[model samples]
Target: MEYITLNNGLKMPIVGTGTNTYGKENNDYNGEVKNEIPELVSALELGYRSIDAAISYRNEELVGRVLAESTVPREELFITTKIPANEEYISSKEATRAAIDNSLKNFRTDYLDLLLIHHPIEDKEQLKNTWEVFEEYYEAGKLKAIGVSNFGKNQLDDLKKFAKVKPAVNQIQINLKEPNKELLAILEEEGITPVAWGPMKTEAHQQEALDEIGKSYKKYGAQVLLKYQIQRGVVVIPKSHNRENQAANIDLFDFELSAEDVEKVENL
Candidate 1:
C-alpha cells in the first residue's frame, strides 16, 4: 500500500477501511453491524493497516475488540476516530475530553493515529476550543495527529489563522460526480491532505463515465474512480463488505492511468 506523510511527519496509508454506516443513505452495516470487529479483522488479514471509525458509528468498541485480539501490533496499524457533531457533544471542552476518553476505551487503544472533528457546526469558538484540547492530547501523546472533516476552504482558512497546529487532513466527499476541484485546489495550496469519503459516491449513483474508463484498463468501475482520486493525491476509504471488492480496492498499485485516460475521466 502507498502512504502519505502528514505535516507533522506521520505516515498514513493512502487507502483504508471506513466504518461509517449510520448516516449513509442506503448502505447499512446490517448483521455485519456486529461483524465490524471481524470486518476489521478481515481488513487487517487482507493487508489493510488503516481503520477509520467515528464515535457516532457506535462500533468503536467492536473495532477495539478486534484490535486487542488480533496479533497486529498497535504501532503497525493506523486507527482513526472522530468527534461526533451532536450539539451536546461539541458544545463543551469537557464533552470533548470525555468523547476522546470514550473513543480510547471503545477502540481499546492508548493513542489514536488520527482524530478529527466530524463536521463543521454553528459553534466556531467551541470547535477551536475542542481543537485546542486535541492539541493537548497530541502533546500528551494520546493522539498522533488531528484534523477536520467536511470543512470547506473558508472554514479551514479560518481555523488556520488562529490554530496553533494546522490541520493535517481535511476529510471530504470526492468522487467522479462530485469532483470538488475548487476545494481540492484550496487544500493543496494549504498543504493539507484530502481524505475522500464515499470515493464511489455513496451507493445510489453510478457514473457511466467511470465504467467507460474502466473498460480501457479492464478494471472495475469503482476501481477506476478510486484510481482517479489517488492520482489527484486524495486519500480514499472505499467501504465494502465483499472481500473481493476490498482486495481489488487495494490492488491499485500495479497500474498507472495514462494522462489521456485521466483526462477522459476528468472531462467526464
Candidate 2:
C-alpha cells in the first residue's frame, strides 16, 4: 500500500477502509453487527492495513474486538477514532481525558494511531480547548496524531492561531464533486494532509465522464474517482460492505492517471 508521512512523522495509508457503515444502521450498544465483523475481516485479508473509526459511529468496541481476534499483528494496522464533536463531556480537560480513555478501552488497546475532532463545535474558544486536550493526549502518547474534521477554512485558520501544537490532518468531504481547492491550499501551506471521507461521491450527471476516462485504464468509475483524489495528494477512507469492492478500492496505486485525464476530472 502507498503511504504518506504526516507532519508528525507517522505514515498513513493513502487508501484504507472506513468503518462508518458498521454503525450506520445499528444502535445496539455492546453488540456487533452481523456483516461488520466479516466485512472488516475481509478487508484486512484483502490487504487493507488502515481502518478509520469514530466513537460517534458506535462500533469501536466491535471493530476493536475483531482486530483483537484477527491474526494480523497490532503493529501492522493503523487505527483512527474521533471524539464526538457535540458531546458535552469535551468541555473540560478531565472530561476529555475520560472520553479518550473510554475509546481506548473500547479499542482494547493502549494507544491510537490518530484521533480527530469529529466535527467543529460552534464556539471558537470551546474548539480551542478541545484541541488543547487532544494535544495533551498526543503528548501523553495516547494518540500518535491529532486533527480536525468538517472544519471550514476560517475555522481551521482560527484553530491554528491559538494551537500550540498544530493539527496533523484535516478530515473532510473532498470528492470529485467538491475538491475545496482553497481549503486544500491552506492545508498544504500548514503541512496538514487532506483526508477525504467520501472520495468516490459523484453525481449521476458526472458518471459518463468518469466512465469514459476509466475505460482507458480498464478501471471502473469508482476507481477512477478515488484515483483522482489520490493524485491530488489526499488520503481516502472509502466505506464499502462488499469484500470485492473493498479489495478493489485499494488497488489504486497500480495505475496513474495522465495529466490530461486528471484535469478532465478536475473540471468536471
Clashing pairs in 2: none
- How far does residue 237 in candidate 1 sit from its true spot (Å)? 0.3
Put down candidate 1 lDDT per residue, 168-207, tens digits, no spaces. Answer: 9999988766778899998898889999988887233456
lDDT of 2 by residue, 85-157 (tens): 7656577777788889998998888899999988887787778778888888899998999988888888887
Q: Each model's C-alpha lDDT? A: 0.83, 0.85
lDDT of 2 at 104: 90
Check candidate 1 and list the clashing pairs. none
Off by over 4 Å in 1: 22-36, 202-207
Compute the lDDT of residue 4 as modeled in candidate 2: 89
User: Over all chains combined, what TM-score does candidate 2 have?
Assistant: 0.93
